[model samples]
Target: MPATVTKTWKLFIGGAFPRTESGRTIKAVAGGTVHHLCKASRKDLRDAVESARAAQVKWAASTAYLRGQVLHRLAEMMQARHGEFVDAIRATARITPRKARDEVDAAIEHVVCFAGWTDKIAIVLGSQNPVAGPFYTFSGIEPTGVVAVLAPDASPLLGALALACPALAAGNAVVLVASERHPIPALVLAEAFATSDLPGGVCNVLTGDHGELAPAMAGHRDIDAIVAAASGKRATALKEGVAENMKRVQVVDPDSDFTDARWRSPAVFRGVTECKTVWMPAMA
Candidate 1:
């Protein structure tokens, strides 16, 4: 008897299944066999950005509390699907089941922790400044609009979504380019987001032609920020590419304490970026 295909997941764009306009497909392998096809195309990216732009205004206007609520719901979803996520990790990252489950747990906890910071980060990272005169001056942390993330290829399942949540909780629309060779987990993430009330393109995940698409994302004008992890000569290339648009780039130091749970603590670095202020009494 032949196997029955009950369902096939499609690219999530504009909250609908608009297959790749270019009709491109990439294969994913497991246990030395190809078992899945992921879609990709230039038009798919365009449609994703369009979906993100459409919801950007309302999403940005929504209060931090509301955004946090959605994030909390996402955490709940992750916990329920823990096994599915671990399977993805074990296959892609080639980790033992025990280690894979640990990574999955870390990913989920990272989301739950980051979500809680949504309402309190600004208060903690934000501050009031002292001016020369009665003119009041203050700075509150704000989202950088649309963010694009190129997840670390080495730690696909855990590292990918780990970065995605922080960007979303900060009120930015994110388009993640998943690992090229390993994509099952990325697709699973897409399914999670689709049902999580993330409002479509807010968290679009595309897998294919990453070497070509990632550099383009850094240069695209619509991408306001990027958080990528890289090392070796490839890391150098990523820096050079992102320079094209001067996107707010953050290069994760490979040898740094990021792997340490302390550095991973939400209150430590999730939304703690700094900003400089200049005042000359309004140029007199």
Candidate 2:
């Protein structure tokens, strides 16, 4: 009889797959097969933050058109590997095939929608101020640097995409903590990110216990912002932990439908960006 090959999955960090420093693994059952997924530790979170911090400047400096093109390429990659996402969602979420397909489709569409916003967001949010002074003042939005996202457990892929796409579109490097309950879809999504034209460390995925990882993400000084799709105590903890850094924190409504057009609003794009006004001498 031929030998069966079993694949071991690791955390996605710095554009590479590395085992968790803690060396802990969680058992996940998918399609009647058992798999071991890395349980990311505090050290892993720190490493991810370093990578994101290093990559954020270059990513933010890229032209808006280039950013849009990269994001669009991500959408195309997701569309090409649509079946893999569907399968992962079905396996981890225990949802029917039809529902799984719907989730996967929604995720891809969300990416595409956010991709379009990469080039238009500044126009929508920025403005030229009418001042009496001879100088021309204009306020423009810029990325908030490293952003941490807590993915919703109910809809792993969809929720993660909902929170991450806007951040990425705004030129922020992201460290996404996947759903503790259903992380397989996140791992599959990480693969899509790796193959996409996204710069390394722009999007890092970690799978493990949210309770343990959320604090690390919230308290990290390098993380300039946080978008959490978690509610109740989890959201409270995140908000409270970030008090030291006073980092921008947004706790989204857990019950909200991620597939709605509302998620694609300019508000989402603006939330992860900081506005700066530049004053220049006007021609007399």
Candidate 3:
């Protein structure tokens, strides 16, 4: 008889998988089997921020159409591995197979839906300003650099995909903290991100204690914004920490259903972008 090899999960940073610098691990027991995942520390968060910052420039420079294509590719990859996600979600959360399948379906659809908005966000969110001068003034949207995403605990895969897809579509790089309670699904999703056309660091995933890591993400100087899908004390802590940097923070209602059609719109893209106005003198 051959001995079974259990895989150890690592942090996905800058397109590479690295063990936590803290050398800490967390145990995840599912179906009488134990899985170990890296316990990311403050140093890991800092490194992810740096990597995201470096990648954001290029990602933002890409054409909106190109970004949309990349997102679409991600959706395709996720759909191809649909079964794996369902199993992962089922195992970690101990949810019914039907519910797990629904989550995976919603997640795939969420990515595809967001992909369609990548090229249209500027049109929907930006406009020409009427100024009292002979000038062409227009307002446009730009990525808010690196963003920190705190995935919700209730629906790990769906919540993480819901938050991350729009941010990436809006041209911002993200450092996503997977659900501390159910991170296996997120780990599987990271594999999809790697195989997709997403650039390295554009969507990094870390599994660890959210209570310990959420503040690090919020207070980091390099992080430009946060999409926090947390509630109660965790949500309060994240919001308060971002106050010091005045970073743009959007707190998702933890009770809200991430699979709702309303969440799949262009609205999520607006949260991770900054408005820029350009004025050009009209030909006289």
Measured over all alpha carbons after superposition, the RMSD of each candidate to the real structure, in angstroms, is: 3.6, 1.4, 1.4
- Model 2, 62-163: lDDT tens digits are 998899889889889999889988888887676899999999999988888888898898899999999898999999999998999889887789999999
The candidates, ranked best first by lDDT, are 2, 3, 1
Runs in model 1 deviating more than 4 A are 1-9, 232-234, 241-243, 253-259, 262-284
Question: Which candidate comes out best when scored by lDDT?
Answer: 2
Cα error of candidate 3 at position 10, Å: 1.0
Residue pairs with clashing backbones, model 2: none
Computed on alpha carbons, the lDDT of every model, listed in order, comes to 0.68, 0.89, 0.87
Q: Each model's TM-score, in the order given?
A: 0.85, 0.96, 0.96
- Clash count (model 2, backbone only): 0
Q: Count the backbone clashes (under 3 Å) in each candidate.
A: 0, 0, 0
User: Tens digit of lDDT per residue, candidate 3, span 1-284?
Assistant: 99998767889999988999999999988888888899999999999998898899999999989998998999899999999889888777868999988889888888888888888899999999999989999999998888899888888999998888878988899999998889988998888889998999898989999889877877787888899877888788878866778888898986679878778776777778989999999985
Candidate 1, residues 1-284, lDDT tens digits: the string is 99966335456665565566776677656666555455677666766776776776677678889998888888788888889888776665667988778777877777777778788767777767887685556776667777767676655766776666667777778777776666667667777777777786678777767666656665676766767665665556567755676667665653343346653454443431334344444344
Q: If both were scored by TM-score, which would come out higher, candidate 1 or candidate 3? A: 3
- Residue 167 of candidate 3: its Cα lDDT? 82
